[model samples]
Target: MTKKICWAAAIYPILGLLGGLYYRELTKAEHFAGDTQLSIVHTRLLALGTLVFLIVLVLDKVFTLSATRSFAPFFWVYHAGMLVHGTLTVLGRESGAAIAGIRKPADAKA
Candidate 1:
């Protein structure tokens, strides 16, 4: 169970890295207007996802939380919430851009 928690915690940094790369690409694009929503996605994925996961791992070690069944549910729900939040944020940004007649670079392919 501890190993499972560690593996789950490790996934966040990789996801955050992917988010950072996407944000970096957007920043480098000439026509991509800087959007706070994208930045929020990057920040929350790193800060809330990666950083908080590590913190939780440390707390679990100190408190011996892996022995408890509640930890599994709590862990899954917390990560799910982060995923949902990030997805909704990106969708909201795209929706807002669409409403304002701003075309996302990715939408150009369609």
Candidate 2:
């Protein structure tokens, strides 16, 4: 579905930008001068979500990818996966923030 692919490409950049803004503002508000999983969320969504769909769009033009039955399932599953991953990344950034007091990814290694 060209419409579906176009929508995915269009929507993901918005989501990515929102993620970037959220990470920056939240970290500043908390005075969190440290590495965070949130830092990667924006890029990950841009690349895996938007960029991947754009690739699919190009391929669709040449190969009529939407004619296949698998396209619908793939479109839905891929979006869901990216959405869940972004959500979890955001959630995990604050994990253990309460009891352990700011356990960053780097802090866990030592």
Measured by TM-score, the strongest candidate is 2
On a 0 to 1 TM-score scale, where does candidate 1 land against the true structure?
0.51
Counted clashes in each candidate structure: 0, 0
For candidate 1, write residues 1-110 as lDDT tens digits. 76766776677777777877875675555345534345555567667777777777888889988778797787776644434433444544433443333434544665
Q: Every model's Cα RMSD, please?
A: 9.0, 6.6
User: Hey, what RMSD does candidate 1 come out at?
Assistant: 9.0
Put down candidate 2 lDDT per residue, 1-110, tens digits, no spaces: 79989999999899889878977887666766655556776887787789899999999999999999998899877644434433444455433333323444554566
Error of 1 at 39 (Å): 4.5
lDDT (C-alpha) at residue 64 in model 1: 85
True lDDT of residue 47, candidate 1: 72
